[model samples]
Structures are given as structure tokens and as C-alpha cells.
Target: MLTRLAISGYRSLRDVRIVLGPLNVVTGANGSGKSSLYRALKLLADIAQGRIIQSLAAEGGLQSTLWAGPESFSRAMKTGRQSVQGTVRKSPVSLKLGFGGTDYGYAIDLGLPLPDSTSKFSSDPAIKSENLWTGEMMGRSNVFATRSGPGVRIRDDSGAWRLAYEHLSTFDSMMTHCSDPHDAVELLRLREQMRDWRFYDHLRTDRDAPARKPQVGTYTPVLAGDGADFGAAVQTIREIGASDEMDEAVADAFPGARIEVTSQGGMFELEMTQHGLLRPLKASELSDGTLRYLLLVAALLSPRPPALMVLNEPETSLHPDLLAPLARLIAQAAKRSQIVVVSHAAALVSALDAEPDSRQIFLEKRLGETVVLDGVPPSWTWPTR
Candidate 1:
């Protein structure tokens, strides 16, 4: 489980770090950088898939996503006594994201490449440095794998640093290329853990949404990010003998309602039997709020849980009354997977905060930088290029 998350030089998250728990609820007003934090986590997951550079490019490259404020805010600037203005940059353009767990930690630094007349992708951000270390915090002695620009090195079993690659791609991550099971066991393990990290932002509930249509029946342990296989996932959960929990979740949220996934001719369709209704309502016939809540249920009750699961604005389209049940479902899921919920709903936030081992992080914009209002920032050290 991730115990600490650190982000710097990304949107409003200019040097932000926070300790995490099994169940973490992040709440803040609009523009408090909740979305930025979510995207940062997603970017970290993308690194393990060898798509970090592509993800950054989709967001208009690094220059557009980098922190726009000054390198640092002075006392007077923060107090509004002085106008906020840019200062001479003391370092190169860098955006870093990292997370530390009890057994391992990983960080990656991205920076703008030097001006090159021959390269049309000069505007793209390059992977500057990366580090995979042991324990809860990174230190010089604990680091096992290191990447500096085009060079990659890993500590052998004899504890000697061995050069792994002389010319690694600037846009590629060591997590993808250097995770050899024989030479870099830690790297391979950490890389796979990161690859299994799941993220669910928007689960469409529109008329044309994929969840509304029947899909081929398959054993789906994990729900699709878009909830296209909602029925298959629910059926898988039921087949795994977790039908009691699934039924309880549905009834808790919708009172007398119970969820069902019917398979006809190898096509599965989701249905919900509610009180006072002679016929069960199909996924396409359900209300927007109801279908969305069911999608969240299927996602949380996934048979194959991830190492980390992140939900962004899950309260969207959810009724106030359903927030408590959703919160309860999320709390239960946290038992199997570390969850980070980014939401603005008071009911959901309060319900999640009351869960055991739950931690609440309230963010606020201070001097145009996102700052945690809960407590002191976690100790984090970024890899230097």
C-alpha cells in the first residue's frame, strides 16, 4: 500500500506531499487541485505502461501542464502584500511524481529536453531521472534502481551498482525497460504493482453509454474503466460467492432494490429489481443516478482488486441519499485494495472519514499552490537529474 504521495511542478501541485492510508478521502473545493492530484496518480500508472510521454503529450505536452507560478512563494507574496510574479528559475523545468509504500518506493522526474534543431519532438518532456528504493522513504543507501537521462543502473544481488542500459530512451521509463526479474527483481515487482493500479474517473451513464447495451458474457474479474463490462463483472462477483455482499450493497443504496445480471445467448445485461415494480428495470431503463451507482458498486466489488484504486468525483450524478451507501461500499473495498477517493460531496466525505483507518485530506489553494490542510507533508526526496 502507498503510504506517501509526492508531486511537484504539476498544475497547482507545486511541491505537494501527503501521507496516505488504506482508505483516503481527498476533499476540496473546485480548483483546489483535486483533479490535478488525480491526474498525477494516473500519470504515475502510465509510466509503468511505457505511455507516460504519450499521456503527457495528450495534455498538450509538459509546458502546458507545468506549474505556472513562481518557483517559490515568499512570505509577502503568500500574504498578498506583494503581487504574485514569476522569479528567475533556479532549476530546469521539472515535473515529478512519486509514491512510497511500506516495502518499496518509486519516483520519476520529467524535464524539458534541450533545444535540438534535428528533433521535431524537442518540445516533448524527457524522463530525466527515476529511482526505485526500499522501505517507506527513499535514501541513498536504500535505492536499488536508478535512471539518469539515457543511462540506467541497478544494484546487483552483491549490492554493486551495475549499468543496465547505456542509452535508454528519454521518453521511456526505466519501470518499463529495466524491470528484469533476474537482475532487477525489485524493479519488476514494483513495476507490476504500479501496472495493476486502477483508476476510474468518468463512468458514462448516457443513453449511448456502453453499460446500457448487452455485452458478450465473460468472466470479468475487473470492471472496465468505462463500465462496458458491468454485467460480466457483477456476474463474476456473484459466481465467486460474494452475492450476499453485492445484494446487501444494492439494498443499502436503493432500499428494496437488488441487482442481477442475466445472460441470454451469451450476451449479458444488467437488471435491478426494485420494490413495487412488477418487472425489473434494465440498465438502459434505470435512472442516471441508479445506473451510475450500480457501476460504482461493480467497480468496488471487483473480484480482482488492484494494489491501488483511485476514484475521481464518484459522487457525480449520485443522489445525496446514496452517498452514504456509496461511502460504505468504498470502505468495504478498501479492505482489499488501497483506495483514494477524490470528491466534493460532504455526505460522502463525512461517511468515509468515519471509517476505521480512513484519512481525510483537505486541500486549499494557497498562493496559487495546492496545500494540504490536514497536517504536515510527508517526507519525500526526488531523484536529481
Candidate 2:
């Protein structure tokens, strides 16, 4: 489980660290940087997949995503004795993200690319440095693998440092370029775990949503990000996963409700049977809230849970009454996987707060920076360039 998450020079998250628990609930008002935190986590996942540079570019390049505030604020400025203003350069401009768990930690630093008129991709940001270390906190002595610019070094079994890659591309991550099961066991394991982190944001439940259409049935242990295979996912849970729990979740949310998957010509369609209903309601016939709730059920009840599961604004269209049931479902899922829920629903937040082992992180903006208001911030160290 991740014990800490750190982000710097990213949007409003200019130097923010969060302590995580088995189940974490991130809640704040609008413009409080809740979404920024969620996007930062997605960016970290993109880094592990060797897509960080491209992801940054897609978000309008590094300059657009970097913090727009001054490098540092003096006490006078913070106390309103002096107005906030930018000063001369002190430290190099960089964006950093990192996370640490009980056994290992990883961090990456990204900065503006050196001017290169000769190359068409000169505008791309360069990965300045990266570190993979053992233990919960990163330090010079604990680092086993380090990446500086295009080069990477890893500690050999004999305790001597050896070059792993002399010309690794700045656009690629060491997690993908130099991860070897034997040569870099920590990197390989961390990379695999990072890849297994699942995120679900605003699953579509429109009239023509993919989940509304029947899809070919297969043994699906994980639901697709778009929830297009929700039927197969729920059916898989009923067959191989916790069928009783799934049934209970459905009935808890909708009294006298039962879900079934019907197959016709190898395509599976979801059907929900409810009390006083003449016939079962198909996925397409269900309301947006109902369909979305079922999709959440399928996701939370996944047979093969990921190392981390993040849900963004899960209570978007959900009714207030359903929030309690949704909270119960989320609590149940937390037993199997580390879950982070970013929501604005008060009822949901209150419900989740009642669970033991759950932590609530309330974010607020101060001096245009995202700050945690309710919990103690975790200690974090960024790899220097």
C-alpha cells in the first residue's frame, strides 16, 4: 500500500504531500484542487507507462501544467505584509511526482528541455532525474537505481554501481527502459504494481453508451475503463468472484433487485429484475444513475482487484439516498484493495469517514497552492536533478 504521495510544481499542487490509508476519501470545494490531485496521480501512472512526456504535451506542454506562482514566498508575503510577486531565479524549474510504500519508493523529476532548433520535438520536456529506492523514504543511501538525463545506473549485487543505460531517451521512463527482474528487482516490481493501478473517471451512461449495448462475453476479471464490458465483468463476478456480495450490493441499493446477464449469440446483455416490474430492465432501459451504480458495483467487486483503485466523483449522478449504499459498497471493496475516492458528496464523505482505517483528506487553496487541511502531511523527498 502507498504510504505517501508527493507532487511539486504541478498546477496548484506546488509542493503537496498526502498520507494515504487503506481507504482514502479526498473531498474539497470547487477550485480547491481536488481534480488536480487526481490528475497528478494519473500523470504518475502515465510516467510508469513511458507516456509522461506525451501526456504533458497533450495537456498543453510543461509550461501550461507547471505552477504559475513564484518560486518561494517570504513570511511577509504570506502574512500579507507584502504582496505576492515573482523573484529572480533561485532553484531550477522542475515538476516532480512520487509515491512511497512500506517496502519501496520512486520519484521522477521533469524540466524544460534544452533549446534544440535542429530537432522538431525540441518543445518536449526532458526527464531530468528519477530514483528508485528501498524503504518508505527516498535518500541517497537507499537509492538502488538512479536516472540522470539519458543515462541510468543501478547497483550491482557486489554493491558496486554499474551503468544500466547510457543513452536512454528522455521521453521514456527507466521503469520501462531499464527494469529487469534480476538486474533491477525493485524497479520491475514497482513498474508492475504501477501498471496494475486502475482509475475510473466519469463512466458514460448516455443513451448510446457502450455499456448499454451488448458485447461479446468472455471471462473478464477486470472491468474496462469505459465500462463497455460491464456485463461480462458483473457476470464474471457472479461466476468466479463474490456472487453473494454482488447480490447483496444490488439488493442493498435497490430493494428486491437482482441482476442477471443474458447471452444471445455469444453477446452478453445485462438485465435487472426488480419488484413490481413485469419484465426485467435491460441495461439500455435503466436510468443513468442506476446504470452508473451498477457499473460502480462491477468495478468495486472486481475479482482481480488492482494494487490501487481511484474513483473520481463517483456520486456525480447518484441520488442522495444511494450514497449510503454506495459508501457501504466502497467500504466492502476497501477490504480487498487500497481505494481512493475523490468526491464532493457530503453524505458519501460522512459515510466513508465512519469506516475504520479510512482517512479523509480535505484540500483547500492557499496562495494558489493546494494544501491539506484535515490530516498530517507525510514526509517526502524528491530526486534532485
Candidate 3:
């Protein structure tokens, strides 16, 4: 489980570190940088998949994502004695993201590419540095693998540093370029764990949503990000996962409700049977809130849980009465996987607060920067380039 997460030079998260628990609830008002924190974690996951550059580009390039604030705010600036303005940059352009768990930790540093008039991708960001360390915190002595620019090094079995790659591409991550089981076992383990981190954000439940259509039946242990295979996933859960818990979840959300997956010509469709209904309601006929709740049930009851699961604004379109049941489902899922729920629903937040070992992080903006107001942020350090 990731115990700490750190981000810098990214949007309003100029410098933010969060301590995580088995179940974490992140709550904040509008423009409080809750979305920024969620996106930052997604970027970190993208790094292990060698898509960080592409993700940044999708967000309008590094220049647009970088914090639009002074390097530091002095006491006079806070008091309004000094006007807010840009000062001479004391360091190079850098955007860093990292997370640490009990077993290992990883950090990546991205910066502007060197000026190259001949290159059409000059605006692309460069991977300035990457580091992998053992234990919960990263330090010079604990670092087992280090990447500086295009070069990479890993500590040998004898605790001696050796070059792993002389030249890697600026866009490639060491997790993809240099991870070897024998050469860098920790790096490989961390990379695999990162790849398993799942995220679900605003699953579509429109009239023509994919989940509304039947899909080929297969034993799906994991729910797709778009929830297109909603029937297969739920069926799989009923077959091999916690079927009793799933039934309880459905009945808890909708009294007298029972879900079934029907197969016709190899295609599976989800249906829900409820009391006083002449016929069961198919996925296509269910309301948006009902479909979304079922999707969440499928996700939370996944047979193969991920190392981490992040849900963004899960309470959207959900009725207030359902929030309590949703909270119960989330707490149950936390027993199997670490969960981070970013939500604005007070009832949901209050419900989740009842779970043991659950932690709440309240974000607030101060001087255009995101900060944690509930308690002190976790301690962290970035690798030097």
C-alpha cells in the first residue's frame, strides 16, 4: 500500500504531500484543487506505462500544467504588503510526482526539453530524473536505481552502482526502459504494482453507453475503466468472487433488488429484478443512477483487486439516500484494496468516516496553492538530477 504521495510544480499542487491509509477520503470545496490531486496520481500511474509525456500533452503541454505562481510567497506577500508577481526563477522548470509504500518507492522528475529548432517535438517534456528506493522514504543511501537524463544506473548485488542504460529516450521512463527482474528486482516490482493501480472517473451511463449494450461473455476478474463489460464483471464476481456480499450490496442499495446476468448467443446482459416489477429491468432500461451504482458494485467487488483504486466524484448523480449504502460498499472494498475516494458529498464523507482505519484529507487553497488543512503533510524528498 502506498503510504505517502508527493507532487510539486503541478497546477495548484505547487508542493503537496499526502499521507495515505487503507481507505482515504479526499474532500474539498470547488476550486480547492481536489481534481488536481486526482490527476496528479493519474500522471504518476502514466509514468510506469511510458505515457507520462502523452498524458501531459493531452493536458495542454507542460507549460500549461505547471503552477502559475511565484516560486515562493514571502511573509510580506502574504500580508499584501508586496504585490503578487513573478520573480526570477531560481531553479529549472520541474514537475515531480512520487509515491512510497512499505516495500518500495518511486519518483519521476519532468522538465522542459532543450531548445531544438530542427525537432518538431521540441515542446515535449523531458524525463530529467527518476529514482527508485527501498522502504517507506526515499534517500540517497536507500536508492537502488537512478535515472539522470538519458542515462540509467542500478546498484549491483554487491551494493556497487553500475550503468544499466547508457542512453534512453527523453520520453521513456526507466520503469519501462531498464526494469529487469534480475538486475533491478525492486524496480520491476514497483513498476508492476503501479501498472495495477486502477482509476475510475465519471463512467458514462447515457442512453447509448457501452454498459447498456450486451458484451461477449468472458470470465472477467477486473472491471474495465469504461465499464463496458459490466455484465461479465458482475457475473464473474457472482461466480468466483463474493457473491453473498454482492447480493447484499444490491439489496442494501435497492431494497428487494437482485441482479442477474443473462446470456444470449454468447453475449451477456445485466438485469435487475425488483419487488412489484412485472419484469426485470435490463441495463439499457435502468436509470443513470441505478446503472452507475451497479457499475460501482461490479468495480468494488472485483475478484482481482488492484494495489490501489481511485474513484473520482463517485457520488455524482447518486441520490442522497444511496450515499450511505455506497459508503458501506466502499468500506468493504477497502478490506481488499487501498481506496482513495475524491468526493464532495457530505453524507458520503460522513458515512465513510465511520470506517475503521479510514482517513480524511481536507484540501483548501491558500494563495492559489493547494494545501492540507486537517493536519501536517507527510515528509518527502525528491531525487536530484
Candidate 4:
């Protein structure tokens, strides 16, 4: 499980460190940077896949995503003696992100490209430094593998350093460049763990959604990001995953409700039988709330859970009454994996908080920056950029 998460110079998050628990709920008011925090975590996942650049571009590029405030507040500015202003280059502007876990830790730094009078890539931001180490916190001695610019160095089994090929690209991450079967076991293990971290934003439940239509069934333990294969995924859960939990989740959400997957040849469809309805309803006929509830149920009851699961703004179209059921489902999933929920719904947050041992991290905006008020704030030293 992740013990800590640190982010700096990303959107409204100037510099922040958050402590995490087995089940954590991140809540705050609108425009409090909860969504940006979720996106920052997603960016880390994208880095392992070598898609950070494209992900940054999709969010209006790195320059726009950088914190719009000054690099840091001066002591004079905070003492009512001076106003907030920029200094004369104490350090280069870089966006840093990292997390510390019981078994492993990682950090990455990104900065704008060097100014080149004749280069077309001068407008792009490049990944400057990345590191993977073995410990809950990153320190000099715990560093296992390090990346600077395009060069990577890893420690060999003989307690000596081994240099990778000297031609790694700045656009690509060290995970993609230096990871091999024989060298850098820590990087390889971390890459696999990063791959298993599942993120679910909003699954489509519109009139044109594919879940409303029948699709060929295949055994899928994990649901797709867009839910295009939701039918197959749920069906697989009933067949191979926890069938009892699947039944209990449905019954808990809607009393006297029973669900099944009807198969005609190779195609599969969702069938829900309610108390009053004489005939079962198809997935296309279910309400948006009901469809979304089932999607969440299928996700939570997966037979194969990931290293970590993140759900962002899950109450977008869900009714207030469904938040409790959603909370129960989430708590069930937490039994097997670490879960982080970033939401603005009081009902959901309260429901989750009511659990036996859940943690809540409330965020707030301070002087145009995001700060995690875990408790009475304390002095924190951010990673030097």
C-alpha cells in the first residue's frame, strides 16, 4: 500500500504531501482541486506506459498545467510586510511527483525543453529525472535505479553500477527504456505494479451506450476503462469471480432484485429481475442510475483486484439514495486492495467514513494553490527540483 503521495507545481497543487491508508476518501468543495489531484495520480500511471506526453497534451499541454502562482511564497510576503512576487531564479521550474510505499518508492521530475533557436521541439516539455528505490521513503542510500536526461544507471548484483544504452529518448520514460528481464529487477517489478493500478472515471450510460447493445462474450476478469466490454466482464465475474458477492451487491442495492446474464449463442446480455416487474428488464431499459450501479458492482467484485484502484467523481449521475450502497460496495473491494476515492458528494463521503477504519483527506485552496489539510499542517520539505 502507498504510505505517502507528494505532488508539486501541478495545476493548483503547488507543493503538497498526503498520507494514505488502506481505504482513503479525498473530499473537498467544488474548485478545491480534487479533480486535479486525481489527474496528477493518473499522470504517474501514464508515465509508466510512455504516454505522459500525449496525456499532457490532452490536458492543454504541460505549460498550462503548471501551477500559475509564484514558485513559492516569501517570508516577507507572508508576514504582511511585502506582496507575493517571483524571485531571481533560485531553481529551474519543474513539476515533481512521487509516492512512498512499504515495499517501493518512486519520483519523477519534468521540465520545459531547453530553448533552442532552430529546433522545432523547443516548445515541448521533457522528463528530466526519474528514480525507483526500495523503501517507504526515498533517500540517497535506498536509490536502486536512477535516470537523468537520457542516461540510466542501475546497480548490478555484484554491488557495482551498470550503465544502460546511452541513447534513451527524453520523450520516453526509463521504465520503457531500461527495463529488461535480466537487469533492474526493481524497475520491472514497479512497471508491472503500475500496470495493475486501475482507474475508473465515468462509464457511459447514455442512450447510445454500448452496454445497451449485445456483444460477443469473452471471459474478462477486469472491466475495460470505457465499459465497452461491461457485459462480458460481469458475466465472467459470475462464472469465475465471486458469484456470491455479485448476487449480494445487487440485492443490497435493490431489495428482491436478482440479476443474470442471458446468452444467445455467443452474445451476452444483462437481465435484471425486480420485485414488481413481471418481466425482466434488459440493460437498455435500466435507468442510468441502475446501469451505473451495476457497473460499479461489477468493478468492485472483480475476482482479480489491482494493486490500487482509483475512482474519481463516482457520483456524477448517481442518485443520492445510491451512495450508501456504493459505499458498501467500495468497502467490500477495499478488503482485497487499496482504494482511493476522490469525490465531492457528502453522502458518499459520509457513508465511506462511517466504515470501521477509513481515512479522509480533505483538500482546500490556499492563495491559489491546493493544500491537503490532513491535520494541523506542519512544515514539509519538498523534493528539490
1-385 per-residue lDDT for model 4 (tens digits)? 8878888899999887888888999999888999998999999998888888899889988889999888888878767598777767668878888888889888899988778889888757798888888867777677778888878889777767777757777788888777887888789889889888999998788998888788899998988877777889899998899998989889988999988889899898999999999999999999998998898888878789998999998888898988998999999899998999998999999999998668899999877878888574323334443
Q: Tens-digit lDDT track for model 3 on 156-218? A: 878999999998999999999888888888888888999999999998899999999999989
Query: Judged by lDDT against the true structure, how good is candidate 1?
Result: 0.92
Per-residue accuracy of model 2 over 1-385 as CA lDDT, tens digit each:
8989999999999989999989999999898998999999999889778888888889999999999999888899899999999988798889999988888888999987788888887767889999998888997688899999999999987879999999988788999989988889878998988999999999889999999999999999999989999999999999999999999999999999999999999999999999999999999999999999999999999999998999999999998889999999999999999999999999999999999899999999898878999666777767778
The clash number for model 3 is 0
For model 1, the superposed segments whose C-alpha errors exceed 4 Å read none
| Segments of candidate 4 deviating more than 4 angstroms | 75-83, 376-385
Quote the lDDT for 381 in model 4. Answer: 36
For candidate 3, the 10 contiguous residues with the lowest summed lDDT are: 373-382
Q: Model 1: per-residue lDDT, tens digit, 242-291?
A: 67889999999988888888989999999899999999999999988999
Which pairs of residues collide in model 4? none
Tell me the deviation in Å of residue 363 in model 4.
0.4
Cα lDDT computed for each candidate against the true fold: 0.92, 0.92, 0.93, 0.86
TM-score of 4: 0.96
Cα-based lDDT at residue 367, candidate 3: 87
Quantify how close model 1 is to the true structure by its C-alpha RMSD in Å: 0.9
Stretches > 4 Å off in candidate 3? none
Cα distance off (Å), candidate 3, residue 259: 0.3
- Please report, as a residue range, the 10-residue window in candidate 4 with the lowest summed lDDT: 376-385
